[model samples]
Target: MSRVSDVYLIAHVEDDVGEAVVTGALEAAGVLGKGPGQIKQHHLLCCSTLDGKVPIVRQLEPELHVDGHSGSIDELKRFLPHLLLVREGHTSAASGQTNVGIAASLASYFGL
Candidate 1:
């Protein structure tokens, strides 16, 4: 099998249909994540191709009030344009949600 290095972006969907879309995108792009089990809150993951680096972007729920957090979605939106988006679903963060997106983008951008 040949593995082509490519950046991956992930976003969490609210419904089964959304999940299907995201999962299909990730699988097609060869991107994987920490899985849903490790996700205590809602978030998204974007990854670059060169070195398999990942960054996690937390999606705030109205209740979590993630906007109040140090790094909110608004902050992330500022950087979204620079990233290649992908979709993924898993059961745990251990699968690679925390740092996949940032790593992937940096790697691809720097040609690492």
Candidate 2:
């Protein structure tokens, strides 16, 4: 891990997705508001579309948004001026992207 940044999660999930999201995934990401990840804010938007995250990002107004989901990157890029696409193999089903600010992994994304 590199220097901890104010991590935030703007996830899109359905209410009945089952399991931890009810109370665990965020904690595992060290996003308990006071933990290793030092997450400043987190939101679980119950929706199937990646575009659901657009409003959250707009409201937060962060300088940069990081995401690996290709479809999401495409949607978010429209609203966010800068987005870091962490390419870790698991990309969106839409297409295998060849352009974007891609990084091999979290560490690489941070230039660690």
Candidate 3:
């Protein structure tokens, strides 16, 4: 197989329905293909954490407002694999919360 030229890591904090919807969309868009020269898509389920099942959507809880802690703490841990790629120079960048943001990131990666 050819080396992957790009990889999209999705670390969404949602229930099964949401995951299924996202997967269906990705698959329909051909982003989930695993062929020789396709951009790879990695799906991560983010409902587990050291702090127990801290649903990422609840990161804004007042009780979770600890110093040196941001809302993305759990997300960071969940997406650590993708972050490692950036750190190791395998990925250029990782930033996105919406389709537009993700599209912009991808465009930047491809010099579009």
List ranges where model 2 is wrong by over 4 Å: 1-5, 16-22, 35-37, 40-48, 89-100
Better structure of 1 and 3 per lDDT: 3
What lDDT tens digits, residue by residue, belong to model 2 across residues 40-79?
Answer: 4344434455677676777877667777676777776656
Q: Count the backbone clashes (under 3 Å) in each candidate.
A: 32, 0, 0
* Distance from true location, Cα of 29 in model 3, Å: 0.2
Q: 1-112, model 1: which lDDT tens digit per residue? A: 0132222234445566776777666556544444332221223443332222223432321211111122333344444333222222321121133322332233343455
Clashes (candidate 2):
0
Count clashing residue pairs in model 3.
0
Ten-residue region with minimum lDDT total, candidate 3? 60-69
Q: Is candidate 1 or candidate 2 better by TM-score?
A: 2
Candidate 3 C-alpha lDDT tens digits along 1-112 = 1153333333454577776777777678766667655545553233423343334334323221111123344344443332211122234433452211122233344566
User: What lDDT, from 0 to 1, does candidate 3 have?
Assistant: 0.39
Question: Whole-model Cα lDDT per candidate?
Answer: 0.34, 0.59, 0.39
Candidate 3's error at 104, in angstroms? Answer: 5.6
- As a whole number from 0 to 100, the lDDT of residue 102 in candidate 2 is 71
| TM-scores for the candidates | 0.26, 0.63, 0.38
For model 1, what is the alpha-carbon lDDT of residue 81? 30
